[model samples]
Target: MDYLIKTGCRKIVHFAAAQHLLIGKNRQNGYLHALYKNGIPVDDNLIFKCDNYNEAAHLTEKLIRSGNTPDAIFAVNDMTALGALSTIKSIGLKVPEDISIIGFTNGLISTMSDPPLSTIEQHGYEMGQIAVRLLLNRLSKDDDGYTPEIRVLKTDLVLRGTTKTLKEDKLGRGLLY
Candidate 1:
């Protein structure tokens, strides 16, 4: 969300997950925080509980038909983002030109898209390894003295062809400040 804001995107459409899931709530909260920090007002109509490919495609097509094309789109996952990308192109819009897109979960599909997708890499492999190690440690414990541990992993922003960055300098030149 911050990436989109920093890139000068004010009207961002978010493809969110269900509110009941903790991960979804966390992501939505982060999205709201980023918008607020960047001084961008939240447009209630721009958000949708869309986390899958079919729903994303349908909603995107509807938005396009309504002539409410967003400046950028932030989807819950790569598949959902891909669906939007396909719809946007089908409607004759160009990625990173008419609109920008970013997705969570940098899966293989992200790189396979036409222009490729910009996404957040959650380091799933590392997460799985950490989980296995944690489980083994707990299992090998002789007593209940071994306390559970929580490991935090950092996510990386992998930029690709489907998005653009517009960094404004102090002098308003194209150079990033």
Candidate 2:
């Protein structure tokens, strides 16, 4: 989210899941931090909380119809992002040009999206492989004292046409509503 803000994104609409999971909470927190850091006052009313993709798409469509289109939408996951994309297009607006959409979890759906969604790559498979390796090491270790290992995977921000280039916005400050 900070990255988005720094890259000239304004008015972030997050599509959170109904269940309050750690991932969802963290993503929301990141949005808040970015808004705060950018000196943009947070607007609680702007946050659209939804249960699933279907609900998110419906709510997003409503917002668009109400003339409350956000500059960028940060979905909790790829599925939700896809839902928003569908709604945005259905409303006769072009992606990135009208509203930039970003999502977490660089799943296949993200890449399959029309413009190819920009997302945060979680690298779940690599993480799982590392976890299995660690477990096997622990299990096969001899009497020699063993120490647990910790591994942190890196996340990359994938660039795609779903977002606009910085030069696209003449005014450095992004659109806010």
Candidate 3:
């Protein structure tokens, strides 16, 4: 979440499934922290909690109609992001031009969306390789107590057409700013 915000994402609309998982909660907290660190006031109304893809699509349509469009949407996963993309397009809004959408897990659906989605690549294979190496090291160690080391795998951002390089136009920009 911090990384996404650091990349210049402003308002973030999170999409989640029916049963929220611990990971989802953690991500939401991270988003909140990013907003706080950047001095952006968090608006609870901006957070739309949906049950599934269908619900998310409905909520997204409502949001766009109500004029509560966000600069970017961070879906809990790629499936939801794809749904949001469909809804946005169904309403005749140009993706990336009107709003930017991002998803996690870099799932297949992300790439298949109308405008391929941008996602966080969770290198599971790399983590598995590192785990195997660690296990081998542990097994080969002599009969002596050893401190267990932890490795945090870094994530990569896979850019795509779902997001715009520039921030969306701010409301009242011409008159206010």
* Each model's lDDT: 0.89, 0.80, 0.75
Taking all chains together, the TM-score of candidate 3 against the true structure is 0.72
Q: What would the per-residue lDDT of candidate 2 be over residues 120-152, giving only the tens digit for each residue? A: 898989988999999898989875867877676
lDDT of 1 by residue, 1-177 (tens): 877777778999999999999778877888888999888899899999999989999999999899898999999889999999999999899998888999999999899998999999999999999999998988889776698686768999999988886666788754322
- Compared with the true structure, what per-residue lDDT tens digits does model 3 show for residues 75-138? 8777777778889999998877777888778977777887999888878789889999988888
Backbone collision count in every prediction?
A: 0, 0, 0
Write down the lDDT that model 2 would get.
0.80
What TM-score quantifies how close candidate 1 is to the native fold?
Answer: 0.87
Model 2 alpha-carbon miss at residue 164, Å: 0.8
lDDT of 3 at 157: 78
Off by over 4 Å in 3: 1-9, 17-20, 126-152, 166-177
Provide the lowest-lDDT 10-residue window in model 1: 168-177
TM-scores for all predictions: 0.87, 0.78, 0.72
Best by TM-score: 1
